[model samples]
Target: MKWRKEEQTPPPMEESAVPDTGWATTSMSTGAMANWTAVVRWSAWGLLLAGPLLGGWALASARTPVTVPTRAEAPRAQPASSDAVAPAGFAELYVAAYVKAGDSDADTEELSAYYPAARSMSWSGEGGAERAESASAVQVRQVSAGYWSVTVAARITSSSKNADSGRVRYFQVPVRAAGGRGASGWTAAALPAEVASPTSSKGVAPELSYGSAHAPLDSDPAVQTVRGFLAAYLTGGGELDRYLSPGTTLHAVRPAPYTAVSVTQIAEHGQGPAEGAEAQVPPDGVQRRLLVDVEGDGKHTGSRPMSYAIELRARDGRWEVAALEAAPALAAPGTKSNSEEGQGS
Candidate 1:
């Protein structure tokens, strides 16, 4: 049997229309490009103008240097329990009053100020008659916290046949300090005890820097300057300004104590202006230090010997007094010095 064939047909798609946008998009892109170019150009101009201004500002600020302040260091704090200072003065006063105490009511009252319980003098009431001329604390040592031992040197005069010839005696006083850090009261722990003099090694004199063996002669300009300056300083015989260095201030002895002053010996520090160079003045700004020995004669007091440590500066080819040294300069230990011969020369 023959079957009938069925025909299969495909369905058609629906159609929709789209508008063209190429022209509008191209126009918008061109406008954005122009705006970007304008922004780049403005930024380049701003950089070019601002670079010189910033450079000028940096250079102007760097012209003057700034000085930084230094920070000060704080001092170290001391412990509260330690006795930072010794009671030397207090011990001297107490010992002075004790040595002069006698058998009188006034003595008891004065002694009570230091030792409240002191009813009588330490010695027996019989023939104890010694007085102190002067008392000074020479040495102080701390034995422990709030305790010290002070050695006082006193010039004592005795009533029995030795008033004119007073002797210096050493007395050790035990002192006690109370409160914190030595800021409070001081008291004597006990009565003073007579002690031997402090022991020291002999032949231990300090070596000074004046070590030149060749003494300056009278023709030396520096020696002449010193002689003239000393004459004015001790005797007021000449004007001080004529011999003083610039910026040096020295006053003559008031009332002109001496009639004449003569420089006896001069010892120079270091090798002075060569051997023959001593006749000619040293160059400007050259300095010389001399240890000079002199004698001063007064109208009534007679001749008195004195020594001076002086410094001289050269100006305008002449020497001028610079300074009267407070003390002679010290040399290294074990170094040989001619300072002993300074007095003898």
Candidate 2:
């Protein structure tokens, strides 16, 4: 019987007044837009004009040589440690003062003549190559189990300074021992006036074999010359003088003379760095790699003809054989035949 009426409330309206936070507001007019456009265009033009100039300046700066400080006094070179380990390939040792042109470094002929029968001449591997010479006084004493202490009286001929000056380097190697061993420990050697029984023929002469020469090595002119020597050496013999680097090494093969009658399988060669930026067998420039299989009939005995390593190099606008590490005998053709030998000819 007692029904009550309820009153409804209306929703509030959104206020249009400003917020309590404080900030600045701005607007762009037509003139302002034009000004901004002008600024952008001017900036683009400026960048375009400065681009080439800045590039040129950068290039010039790069080309400019940098200043390096020079030492006031002469620079001294550090000598190798005597106690250092000998090179792995060190095969023999010889105490000599000079390495003459015709002298045999492989056999120590010059050394033998100089220091004849003073004491026993015992040698093993781990001694670097030795060149026989005519120095004033030279003695070789074993410093370590595998090392030798060579002392010289500071001779004028064999010194590094004389050799660098391109002079006729004569030298005398002084003998030294690790202990306070006096001259008694040093063996005396005699010097001969002339080299005896020199080999005129290439068939028996020592050959200089080379691997491949890469940068900083094959680029050297001396390395090129040595390669040339190998080329002449391969074909029995040619102009040895045309080749033959100043420090060219001489190799000796046992069982008497090592002869190279003919070299074959040159086409089987690969590429190496000894060549000067060119293909193998190029008329001029260097060759990088050479895999040579030599074939020759000599005093060597085997089931087939003897072969030797005829490593080659192409540098200084020429192809040259660089190595002959002794060739093995060629086996009979067996089941295979020489049918591949003949071509269009």
Candidate 2 versus truth, CA RMSD in Å, comes to 26.8
RMSD of each: 18.3, 26.8
- Candidate with top lDDT is 1
Model 2 per-residue lDDT tens digits across residues 254-340: 332434443333322332333353333454433333333444444554323333444444445565544444552232434221222
- For this target, which candidate reaches the highest TM-score against the unseen true structure? 1
Looking at model 1, which ten-residue stretch has the lowest summed lDDT? 14-23
Stretches off by above 4 angstroms in model 2 are 1-238, 241-260, 264-283, 299-318, 321-345
